[model samples]
Target: MTLEHKRPRLEIEYCTQCRWLPRATWMAQELLTTFEKELGEVARVPGTGGVFEVRLDGEGVWSRKSDAAFTDAAELKRLVRDRIAPDRTLGHSER
Candidate 1:
């Protein structure tokens, strides 16, 4: 029998001091809903100093400070899909 590899975990670090929970949670929800089968988990990590970063399997995928802007749901989904399920289409999310 072949072993099945586990899906990648997604971590979203947001600044609690900056009150970014809603934004972070929303993004997490979107990712979870979109990749319910492909993702292992979507963790929301509390952080400070205006932090907003997304990671997959410990690899940095996106950073708000570095990008100088928040990533929209569609763009973020595309980034995640490219990493986890490149061939899978995101339907309306792609448009």
Candidate 2:
């Protein structure tokens, strides 16, 4: 019955063979910090074949395979905010 359970959950799936855990972990930290109240939990899911995807409530918001690039912190924050807290301003991230 905590806010954590009520809010949405984010999942970052990264390729283990590609050594993307640090990148995924960093993104998770950024999201958890920015959307602390808006997000229920941020999970790091291990995968393979150079996969790096960000999912909110099981829906993908960003994918390296399709986007052809890793999402920057600001862009990731914006994408996440738009989905979970559209009205919330991301301060410097808005720039």
Candidate 3:
């Protein structure tokens, strides 16, 4: 018998403005904490508007987990509501 579980997931938008976005790091940390609570982990690649692969421990990440982690999406109304805007205000892929 096997107990199936959902994989942990997070999206990180690395800065493409040449300057670092500290908030992005904070976002990842917050996700790590959230996932950790569920006994899961994430796989991340460091790059501007980078994609992250998330899953349970031992289920190493794959390229498929990646997507558009950057850009100021109109869909991110919650992100805008939740945090202060960056001085740069440029999404990872903006450049």
Candidate that scores best on TM-score:
1
Best-to-worst order by TM-score is 1, 2, 3
lDDT per residue for candidate 1 within 1-95, as digits (tens), equals: 13377888999999999999999999999999999999989999999999999999999999998898898999999999999999999999888
| TM-score of candidate 3 against the unseen true structure | 0.34
For 1-95, candidate 3 gives per-residue lDDT tens digits of 13565544444434445443464455456545433544344333355543333222434222223444442333232332233223323343233
Give the TM-scores of the predictions, in the order they appear. 0.94, 0.94, 0.34
Pairs clashing within candidate 2: none
**Model 1 weakest 10-residue run by lDDT:** 1-10
Off by over 4 Å in 3: 1-3, 49-95
- lDDT (CA) for every model shown? 0.95, 0.92, 0.39
- Model 3 residue 28 CA deviation (Å) reads 1.2
Residue 34 lDDT in candidate 1? 98
Provide the lDDT at 2 for model 3: 35
Model 2 lDDT tens row, 1-95: 87555888899999999999999999999999998888889999999999999999899999998987777999999999999889999998987
Number of the candidate with higher TM-score, 1 or 3? 1
Task: Judge candidate 1 at residue 49 and give its lDDT.
Answer: 98
Query: How many clashing residue pairs are found in candidate 1?
Result: 0
